[model samples]
Target: MLHLKDGLSFKPGLSDLGALASHYTVVFLLLTHTCGGQSDPQPMVAMAGDDVILPCHLETAADASDMTVAWTRPDLSPKFVHVRRDRMDFLINQNPLYQGRTSVFNSKLKRGDLSVKLYRVKLSDGGTYSCFIPDLDKESTVQLVVGQWILRSLDLFNAAF
Candidate 1:
């Protein structure tokens, strides 16, 4: 005897075995379809005051025009850095610290390029950033390392002298 959530109860018999197997197959297919994307975290190095791009893309080629893409820094205030929804960039809820400093490649959105460009990187910008696509339930992390530019310039000057 089996009881389903729909309040359906039935006794299993030899003829009912095929129907049971079919139900299991459908469940397995749905699970695989929903969990098809992959997330890969990458490390990025940048000089202070420089611009950098954080990469995130789907394994298979697919249009992401209708997907909701979000960039967040969990350790920072106003966690959201950049968010795109309904084919438009929404920043009303973005962190004030990141205002006017972040943007996505709009033309590339259709090609599944959810990467975000951050301008004028600061020392405080060195941290882990998460790129999430809610529709696919996929997300990836990117670690940013910001280096002091003045020190590097000084080293280069001394080496050339």
Candidate 2:
């Protein structure tokens, strides 16, 4: 069984699919810390199809201009949604669906923040997003939910079903 932090155990071997379905459950755990790490938490909540801001706040006084910062979706692990360099603008090298609709908060970046603003949100965009900055010991995540897009996806799913 693959034991997850959320009390979910995905058994590799199962007699029946129905039996396996009953074993999945979600558990919430509160995690707290007092220190230095490569990431921080910046959450964003927005209506589907509307723009939203995912803030990446660097709490400490860290000089991050030399670091390579990237915002990616964890669901699509190892895929970068957007990338930014020390002197370059936000570049959309991957994920064509996200082109022309994402940018970083300039004011925040000037203040050691690396938050990103996503426009024309889609249901597929709803997932755990992360900002990773190398060498500042920094990485942060923000949860995104595209409600309207989700509803639409669900409708399509049901119709297919």
Candidate 3:
């Protein structure tokens, strides 16, 4: 038994699955739209001079150390942030800003862990980063909010002063 406002009600049964699903579909769309469609629960945050891991995963048991993993920032000119290929780091087209500050887990790549670690994070590092596996056509994104906590701390200090 399901009840809705405006005196509407339903006695859902096997035959009424279609109707129930239709109502659920409408509700799902409404909720998502109302939430502004931003599905990421929370953006990753890191302070200046800290290390942060921008997580990406393949969710497979296959070995991927030999596969090419492309980590890029779409807003950057060169775009390619860190790329691994042929069992070695390929930096031919990597962005200069990330030249010596990024790396992956060598031991975990066999399990499809494509996450990258950013060393000594800077405020300029705050942005959307993406990881893509071309051969598998799989990709994921991580939003980094760098130094936000520092900003909040400054705000508190100013208020106290």
Taken over the whole model, the C-alpha lDDT of each candidate is 0.72, 0.61, 0.71
Which structure is stronger by TM-score: 1 or 3?
1
Report the number of the highest-TM-score candidate.
1
Which runs in model 1 stand beyond 4 Å of their true positions?
A: 1-43, 152-161
What would you estimate as the lDDT of candidate 1?
Answer: 0.72
**Candidate 2 structure, TM-score to reference:** 0.59
Model 2: residues with Cα > 4 Å off, grouped in runs: 1-44, 61-63, 90-92, 149-161
Span of ten consecutive residues with least summed lDDT in model 2: 26-35
Q: How big is the positional error of residue 28 in model 1, measured in Å on the Cα after superposition?
A: 48
Model 3 regions lying over 4 Å from their true place: 1-43, 148-161
Q: Please, what are the lDDT tens digits per residue for candidate 1 over residues 65-97? A: 888999999998889999999989999999988
**Candidate 3 lDDT (Cα, whole model)?**
0.71
Model 3 residue 23 distance off true place after TM-score fit, in angstroms = 52
Alpha-carbon RMSD of each model:
24.5, 13.1, 15.7
